[model samples]
Target: MKITCVGGGPAGLYFALLAKQRDPRRDIVVVERNRPDDTFGFGVVFSDATLDNLADADRPSYGAIRASLAHWDELHTHFGGRVLVSRGHGFSGLSRQRLLAILQDRARELGVVLRFEEEVSDPGEALATSDLVVAADGVNSRIRERLADRFEPRIDVRPNRFVWLGTTFPFDAFTFYFEESRHGLFRVHAYRYQPDRSTFIVECREDTFRRAGLDRAGEDETVAYFEELFADKLRGHRLLKNRSVWRSFPTVHNERWSAGNVVLLGDAAHTAHFSIGSGTKLALEDAIALVDCLGAHAGVPEALAAYEAERKPKVLALQRAAQVSLLWFENTERYMALHPLEFTFSLLTRSLRVTHEGLKARDPAFVREIDAHVASKAEAQSGVRVVSADAAPPPPMFTPFRLRSLVLENRVVVSPMCQYSAEDGRIDDWHLVHLGSRALGGAGLVITEMTDVSAAGRITPGCAGLYRQDHAAAWRRVVDFVHARSRARIGVQLAHAGRKGATKRMWEGMDRPLERGAWPLLSASAIPYLPESQVPRAMDRADMDQVTSDFVQAARRADEAGFDLIELHCAHGYLLSSFISPLTNRRTDEHGGPIENRMRYPLEVFDAVRAVWPADKPMSVRISATDWAPGGLTTDDLVALCGMLREHGADIIHVSAGQTDPSSKPEHGRLFQTPLSELVRLEAKVPTIAVGNIQSYADVNSIIAAGRADLCALARAHLYDPYWTRHAAAEQGFAMEWPDPYRSVERYTLRMR
Candidate 1:
């Protein structure tokens, strides 16, 4: 087989070498636009894990690269008049020039043709001649662009501006510096790649760049400014430049990796942000995977298909992480207000790939110190010290949290989960066991499932309610038991189903209409919840007044039941949520059009409920921060909504996302919705409870310590294990008490795994 690789970068050169080595009879030629020694970046960094793949793919190049690599295990963070060191993270770096030289030599030795300083203005010529053509060109690939009609590329140019340069300062560890300037905040990503040199990168917001006068400055002025800004860490070392210009990082993504006999590799296919240091590593790995797939498959189409099918998922995952890290750096100014240690921790875990436990595994001592810092601040604020000076501080999840008169024992909350076993909107034994066990299991607060304000408002026949005076008695029994038997505070989430009403139970079929006895639903507009479902009547003044009355009555009943707090369920495509989301709400009256008008009805209900509820008791409003559809509510909308809720006497905001429309497309991952909560808490200046996909005590601790949310609500974790808090406490060796009756079994249960 004859192969032509375009752009003699890592991907092209490495693929040429590997394919030739795998089959000595095969012929390979690499085309390049620059000399072997000419490279744009100063250095390339990789995790120690990448070396194993390199060794397995080709030992000679691996040995050559490893011989010149600079390895480090510690990360030094310089910020806020202090330097924090975290150990046990292994990384290796090498000069980009040296890496290219090694790959070029290896390919030549394997009988692969190397043609440098030759630009291929047209990649089609090679595709017409070679059996398979590899588009290994870098991020600005002409080949990918020429075939853009088939490739379907999407490029996202980020906001922050950054420039790459080199320095003679021999840094011994991976280091980052955050410095405050008169203009704004600036950051440095620097690390040693050789004995006498390091890669230095400067990044700041676009506004900050303009403020610092670097946007219009020449290369020399730009380098001089960064040298002076970070002079303290540089220790008088000078900055180096080679075509260094400030620009935004464009994240490139292609819908298809292959077109006909031509295929894209490395940056030609996708580009992860440089903040995660995966550009070189992913480029190299792509070469290895592409070569293996070609060797395993006979047909070019089959090989390219197998390669993309295997590699896209991994690349997309890393890109997602890289995007998170990029956003963190872009928003560095917002987090600089935190305590120094907390700020450092937030930076380390910004990608969401790292967790509290993951950091603990890397450096237990550093994590412990962070915990101590968080515990000290938590203790100072709550005025309840649980640990002595010599004792290990309690995990952030076990720290106390307060909202108005409700003082929670810890920050863990049992999220309201629907249990379709209620009869006529009244609680039964199933509700008791479902909630009581979690309360006994040692949560700080256990929130009851979506309790409807009226019988017609219930989602299913089995949904719990706070509508009737007798219904309050049923819930009162459960609330009384939780208060008497454990330290857990119980709250109720009162909701009205709106257009989504009269649905079958979730187990039967979510959002399916009931076979019989379906009730008429009311909504902000006369829209159906689903294409085949019931069309709800658009709510008029009378319907709005009745709903407001229903909510007020529910709050009164909740007070009578002696609940610790109340959460107004204004999220998840319910009545109030429908009014807030543009996708669902369409009216010509005062409660429509702009976001302010859209939020009017929800605010009116909140005001009425606040008047009827006690002054000392806290009420929270759950809101869908984003509709996950075009022209819908977003985190920006939440800022104004949260401010309005706060003005109406809401003590906290429960942040959730999506579910406002059935066609909504949500990006799901670990703690996916927590960013929404973080935005609400920071931008909106309100306390928020983060819900959705939060699992494990470490997640809770990280969320609280990072100030992303005031409290964390875990739904599936609580359902999977009623004693999740106790188990977390036991795992951390914290002495969390169990009820006296269950104390005997606690010892054995805690040890059960």
Candidate 2:
């Protein structure tokens, strides 16, 4: 078999050597566009985990790489004129030139032919006779460009500008220096790779680069400027340049990694941001995966598919982490206002991979210090003494949260879950038991399911409603029982299903039209929920007035029922959400077209409801932060909408996503909606309730402590375990209230100490 590899970087050389080692007669050749001794960049860093993989792949190469590495276990952050050091983060760095040389020597020893300084302008012509073509080229691969139509690459050039250079600083640990400048905030990511030299990367926002005149300056001048800026850490060491020029980091992604005989590897297929230091690690792992897949499968196409299937998800996860790290650097200015300890903690956990528990394991004393600091601040603000200096404080999830006149006992919220157990828009036994059980289970806030504003607005005949006095009276029974029996505050979600209404029960094919009776629906536009479903009437001025009046009546009813909060359900392709999303709202009137006009009716409805609702009681608006489809609402749009809602009178934003259209494809994962919540909370400067798949106590603790959201709502978790909050308290060793009747059971279980 003849295999031709393009680009003689680490990926190409490593794959060629591994393939040759697997079978000596494979006939592999590696082509390079640079001299064997020449390479760009200073050093490449790797985790101990990656070294284990290298050893498993080939012991000799792993030994060589390990021998050349400079190991460090500390991360130092120099900010606010104080250097904060975090310990137990293990990392190893090796010179890039040494790594390439090691791989080149191994490839030659394995009898794999190596070609250097021979650029193949057309990769297709160079590998025309080979049975398999490996495009292990760098980010600007000519092979990938030659087959651009087939590859379908998407390159996102990030906003921040960075330059990679080297210095003889001999830093003992991985260091990050943040210095405020007349231009802007400048940062350095520097770590020693050898005894005498270290890799120093200077980065700043684009405006900062231009303000500092580095955009017009030559490479030497740019280096000189950063040298003076970070001179304190450099200790008079001079900066060295090897083709160092400021450039925006391009994150490259490909729809497909392989086409017929040609397969992409490493940077040719994807490029992770350098902030995570996974570019070399990922490249080497790709080589290992490809060789292993080839060994496992007999056919080339099968091997390529298997390799892609095995490596893409892992690479994408790292790319996501890298993207998070990159964004943190880009927006460091926002976090600069935080206390130094908190700022360092935020930087450490920016990728979302690290958790409070993980950090605690790494440095228990540091975590305790943070907890004590937070406890002191909380005590000062609320005048509620908590956690004496001798004892550690409870997790952030257990801390009280105050909104307007309501002060929650904790941050845990029982998210509204649809029961679909109502009759003629009246609640029954199921509503009382379902909501009452969660309140008794010790959640700070308990929110009811999507209660329709009117009978015609119901998603199904079984949906709860608060449009009638009878409905209000029925809910009053449940609310009064919860208030009298537990310390939990109850909230009502008032909604109008709009285009999504008049459907069968969720168990009997949700969104399907009823077989016997279906009511007429009203929406922002006359669009059918499904192809065969009923087409809703485009709401005229009269229809809009009636709907708005229905919501106001519901709010009045909710207030009469003694609800603590009312969340306007403007999400999930419902009536108000339809008006917010362009995918659902298609009209030529003043109520449609541009976003401002589209938001007009929703704003009017909110204003009407707010005018009647008690000012002391907080109001929230649940919105689909993104439609998860093209030509739909985006995060930026949601930010603007949230700001408008805040101005009108929204106390909190319930952050949710998708379901705006049947074609919407949401990216689902654990705590997937939290990022949207974070964006809305920080960008719009409004308190946010993060919902969607937040199931664990650790998730709640991390999110609340990071200031990502003021509250976290759990939906399915509550359905499965009504005592989720109580059990979480037990897990965290924190005290929580349980029903007096269940005290004996709690004692038997030894949950309360």
Per-model CA lDDT versus the true structure: 0.90, 0.88
Model 1: which residue pairs collide? none
Scored by lDDT, model 1 comes in at 0.90
Tens-digit lDDT string for candidate 1 (576-681): 9999998999898899988899999999999998898888889998989998888888656779999889877899999988898999999887888888888888
Model 1 stretches with alpha carbons more than 4 Å out = 749-753
- Model 2 segments beyond 4 Å from truth? 125-127, 380-383, 586-590, 593-595, 634-636, 744-753
Quote each prediction's TM-score. Answer: 0.96, 0.94
Per-residue lDDT, model 2, residue 111, is 95
As for candidate 2, its clashing pairs are none
